[model samples]
Target: MPIVLYHFPLSPPCRTALCTAKALGLDVTIKIVNLLAKEHLNEDYVKMNPEHTIPSLDDNGLIIWHSHAIATYLVSKYGKDDSLYPVDPAKRVVVDQRLYFDATTLFPRLRATTFPLMFLGKTDVEPDKKAAIYEALGILEKYLEPTGWVAGDHVTVADIACAVTTATLQAMGVVLDAYPKIREWLERCNSTIPHFEEANKEALKDVAELIKSKVTHNVYAP
Candidate 1:
């Protein structure tokens, strides 16, 4: 059976796993879980992942949830190149640690600062959220360099994982103009991975419309 990847595009965690899958040349049957339907919060999905979240991998009937865990599992099991996930124990440890930080720390902060305005349709708080976004971006700025990737010289799965989240957050209208390194890194990641863009083909339009609708409605309405 083909591996099944459960995901919701709007979710950063789901995108992380998807990015890793793309990077590794894995043939996955994507099951777009409906987060909007609260399907993730429902009992059936909860059985697959008690946390009730996505970017989960179902491999020949075995389920692995949590985006970081799923991505690590894929790399450990099926990565085509060592650069995608280094075999060196120390390098792997550093990359895995960063993956955890990106998954639990950076991603949550980005969400806290953007999701309320973007997904929740809450426009009145955009200015405040934008400030929070800059703060979180500054955190990311500290780790980023002109090195062309995150975590190392080679574009590891860590870069794929973090880039997907950062790209989505930027797509949500969190300004990245000040973070030139991040912008360059994003382009580098896209150029390196052919499948990341394919999997996210519809995301740009949706995010653009969502941001525009909220901003326009908020600005014009009395």
Candidate 2:
């Protein structure tokens, strides 16, 4: 059986897997799960990934769930560029650490702040989530300036994982104005990487539209 990637465009973890797959130039099939339809909650999907998550990877019938696990598995199995998932022990550890932070720390806070607004279509209480979101962005900004990427001097699974969350935050009206370094880093990541733009496309339109609407309202406010 060929490798199949179960995913959703809006899901950060799913996008992480997608980005990694693309970066490796792997010709894996993508099965786009519909988050809006709650298709992922179906029993079949649940069986594949008991968690019923967006990014359950089927690798020649060996199923793997979780973005971090999928990423490592892909690199270990198929990555041509050692740069994608470096061989150095220390650099590998850094990638692992960043992935851990992305899965636990960065994603949770970002989702808490933005998911309620974007997925649920609720504009209320945005101000309540703003502080936490800003803090998260500030942390990313600080981290980007001192390092070449989240894991080291090269793009790794860490950058791919975090990029999903970063893209989502940008989509949900999280301002980047305060995080100049992060903005610059994002540019570098998208420009330098072949598949970063593909991974980012879904969120880009929504993000730009959201920002434009907000800015227009503010500009015309009495």
Candidate 3:
């Protein structure tokens, strides 16, 4: 059987795994999982991923969850070269830092804002949550100043992971007024990354519509 990806289209993290597979040029069968419906909580799914996260990858018999881990596995096992994940220790750690920042800082902020809006019908993000997201983006801007991409000069899983989050934030009405570098990098990502549009085509639209229904204004400036 081909590699099976348990995915939810609206998830930013799932987009990372899908983008990595596209970049690696691997054929993966995507089986949609509804997080809103508690599909990930199913016994079969929890057995494969105790965390029950969206975007679990079953590569043959090796079941992997968490977008960052799944992405690293696919890249390490199948990448023709180490470009997406450099082999050098120093370079790898830089990429690792950006990946971790995305997981801990960038995406978490997005989740913080969106969860309440999507589930609890909150119209405005709490002030501290807005501040946290912009703080993460400010650091990201400086990271990109040294190199066009987040990890380094070239796109890596770090950029792929963070791009989805930032792009979703944009769709959710977070203006990029202060983060010109991030704006440019995101533009470059859309053009340079393979299957980038296909990777996020519907998710962005869905996010826009969903967010539009919840909030009347765009936010997070400077």
Residues 77-167, candidate 2: write the lDDT tens digits.
8977678787889788878888888888888876674455456655544454567666766777766877757777777888888877887
After superposition, which runs of candidate 1 have C-alpha atoms over 4 Å from their true positions?
118-121, 126-129, 217-222
Candidate 3 local lDDT, 1-222, one digit each (tens): 799999998999999999999989999999999987889899988888898888899877998889999998899999999999999999999999999999999999899988998888788888899888888889989999987998877999999999989998888878888889999999999999899878897899998998888878764444
lDDT of 1 at 69: 85
Candidate 1 per-residue lDDT over residues 146-194, each given as its tens digit: 4556777777878877887788776766667788888888887778786
Ranking by TM-score: 3, 1, 2
Better of 1 and 3 by lDDT: 3
Candidate 2's displacement at residue 18, Å, is 0.3
**Of 1 and 3, which scores higher on TM-score?**
3
Top-scoring candidate (TM-score):
3
Quote the RMSD, in angstroms, for model 1: 3.3
Which candidate number has the best lDDT? 3
What 10-residue stretch in candidate 2 is worst by lDDT?
Answer: 213-222
Find the number of clashing residue pairs for candidate 3. 0
Q: How does model 2 fare in lDDT?
A: 0.76
TM-score of every model versus the real structure: 0.87, 0.87, 0.96
